[model samples]
Target chain A: MRKNDMRPDELLKMDRRLVLSATGGMAAVMLPVVLTSFIVSETARVVAAVLVYAAAIIMAWAFVKRYVGILNAQHRESEKKHLSEIAMLVQPITTHLNNRALIIPVLTNQLNEVTKQTESAALDIGEKFMSIVQRARNQAKKASGAFGRFAGNGGSSSESLTDLSKKALSDVIESLRDMVGVTSQTLKNMEVIIEDAGNIKRIVTEIEYIAEQTNLLALNAAIEAAHAGEQGRGFAIVADEVRKLSDRSNAAADDIRKLISRVETDIKGIYSKTEKSITESSARSLEAETVVNDTLRKIDDVIGEVKKQLDELGAETESLAKDISSIVISMQFQDITRQRIEHVIEPLMSFKAELEDITQKARSMSEKIHEWEGNSSAEWLEKMYTMESEREVLKEVLKNG
Target chain B: MGKTVLIVDDSASMRQLVSFALRDAGYDVIDAINGKDAMSKLNGTKIEMVITDLNMPEMDGIEFIKQVRNNPGYKFTPIVMLTTESQESKKQEGKQAGASGWIVKPFTPEQLIDIVKKFAR
Candidate 1:
């Protein structure tokens, strides 16, 4: 029968007293005949009456034994029915507890494995985070060091590199200007020297003209002296000497004129070359300055970019370090979580233990109930006591849970 | 020459992390799976410093430190322990075994590097 359909009180409510009372009434009716037969007996009759009374007593004893046997059979049948009902009441509960006990270990093992994996994963993540942040910090420091060294070379921190290069270029240009000025002055001096040479050539020409006239005057005086005879001879001699001296002086002036002409030619050639050289050098200088300024500007742009990158790297490294630290702290949560899981496992284990106790009790109680129904009354009562001990254990499980 | 550091840990990920960090900081790194592996790698190789985990299979950090200290070539080498064990007694055990210092688990990269720089160089 279903546990819900079987009531213990209803099973135990059977009345055996009605059969006992009917047996008692049958015995009382048979007793009066045996007493009358004993009262009328002579010697032979007395023996016969005694025999009838003995037979009646024997019949009454058999009837009482039969009634007791019928009652014992009914009691045994009732006990068998009770045992069946108790087994039905406990079977499902025992099966349910057994299944729960079987599942608990599996669940606990899975939980432990998950907790272990989580801890491992958290530690792994923490390590990776540390590595990344460390790499970033190192790179930042390197870049910053390189940038500092580069910028430090410029001396004053506030000075713009472009301005420094510009100032250097301006100095070079000023020197070029001084060189150009000196070249211009040298050309002017060459011009004045050339004009002085032209003036000397004209003076030499006038000397040559004076020498020719003196020679012509000496020729005329010589002819007049010849007509005057001896007095003219002395005058002719004086004119010849004066003509010779004048010719010599003209020859010297001619040589001086030729030297001045050569000197003026050389000075003119020098002035022309100097002027061309100055022009070429000035053009080259300006080209060089432009190239230098362009280069400086490019260098300035590169430096600015490098500095900006270094600054950003520094900031990023700082941010990464903070992020890594936070992640490292977060890894601690795994430890706490594992501990919490352990706490959960503890209760689950206890529950499993209690369920196992209950299942054992149910199985034992069912076995004892079977033994009680099969065994003699004395043996059945002893087994019933053992069943009560099992019940107490099950009850304890229920109370603990 | 770049500075060389030995990183010993049972966890492959942890070893990778430490090696990467040290390499990034311009130091050359030698990786070992455990203290025993670290011992094999240390033969005749010049190591400036060592970073190891305390709990590991085969050989632990304390014993590794002791072995490193006993080696004539690495007598003065600095050894740092990286571990989950935070107890003072455990720390003392490592220290007694010749560890230069110790860092708890989940330590920041910066903290690790700083210790490395101080001890390694």
Candidate 2:
């Protein structure tokens, strides 16, 4: 039968048996005493019987009290043993909690160092990046401005490449125009020389005609002198000499006419060649001017493209600097994480302390385990919370629980 | 030379964080492990401000603030409590112990700098 099912008498049967056995043995010894007392006198025998009954009752009471005392001692010993066992079981858990609590600070310290280093590095990177970007921006601006001036976009006082190219091309075109003007003037002078050559040819033709006529006249005079015979011998000799002079003059006139005709032909040939040269030079000058202008325009376009690219580079660098700043700002989470870990460490340390107290109490078995009290869970939860979010969670838990 | 600020906390990470923020803001920072250590560091230095955490060993922030208030040199120095404790009772205790301001933990660098600029001499 289960112990709870036992009757009160059955539960006390051992004590009752001890009391009855003691009473029975004492009564047997007391009965002989009472009978011996009867030999003295009736009153003495009655008093002796009463004394025997009292002695038996006293002996039974002492025996039962001793047995109960032994049982109580055994129960106390068992309780102490159980408490010690509990202490032994709890010791390792307390130690583990203590170790965790002790190491958390160390871990946080190391984390702090790591975070500090990272923050310093990130800040340094940001500062350096900003500095570099600033420098690059300044350089790019300068380059863009210079290119603008070179491309003649900005109204810079200094001569730009486009302006210079235009000026040089203008100078070349003006020089070509001047050359064409000079060639035209030369062609006009050639025309005047051709006209003068015609006049010289006409004069030479006139001299040739005069010389031929004089020769004919002298020949007629000589014939007439021959017909007059001896008397006109003297006149005939003179006419004959005149005729020889006329013949020589006519030959000289013929040479002069031939020379003038060749001179006219050479002057006409020079005029025709000079006119063709002037026409070709004018065409080439126009082509050269067109090519120079087109080249200048292409150069201007290239400079514009370079300036645009430089501006984009500067903008991109500025964006990178902003990103670095954001990264440096994000590093603040390390401290927040450290606080959260500390919250955990605090509870573990408290638990360790309470466990240690319990273990000490259990070991001694002098203090009641139920008497021990620690901070309430709510109090611990409230105390451990360091952040608003944690407090909100606590509120939720309390509200729900 | 910049203004000097002292940071007192038991957690190394917290001290580092506060120190980093203050230093980044161009303030000279001196850090101590706890209230007792912080007290020892107050030796005639021209500390413009003190930011400390509560629940430190050797001496807590409240007692440290009281001690600082007791000292004639630091009596009027602005002491701001930087701690995890957000309870009104703790805040009142800190205020009564002569804290000039209170900042909960996990504060942004901007907030810390703003408070420093507002209070530091």
Global lDDT scores for all candidate models: 0.78, 0.72
Please give the lDDT score at residue A280 for candidate 2.
Answer: 93
| Candidate 1: C-alpha lDDT | 0.78
Per-residue C-alpha lDDT of model 2 across residues A1-401, encoded as one tens digit per residue:
34464468856975576677767776767675856664678777767777776776687666666566555544444454555556566667656655665675676566656656755654455456446645765877787777766766656565877687778887988899899899999989988887887887787677767767777877787788889888778887888787777777767766766776777678678778878988998888878778877876776677667767876876776565444434444444554555565676667666656756765654444234322211234454565566989989988887886
* lDDT for position A371 in model 2: 24
* lDDT computed for candidate 2: 0.72
What is chain B's TM-score across the candidates, in the order shown? 0.96, 0.97
Segments of candidate 1 deviating more than 4 angstroms: A1-90, A101-192, A195-305, A308-401, B1-106, B110-121
Question: Which 10-residue span in candidate 2 chain A carries the lowest summed lDDT?
Answer: A366-375
For A29-127, candidate 1 gives per-residue lDDT tens digits of 666555555665476566665676677667767766655665566566567787878888898989998999999999999999988798679767867
Local lDDT at A355 for model 1: 97
Docking class of 2: incorrect
Worst 10 residues of 1 chain A by lDDT: A377-386
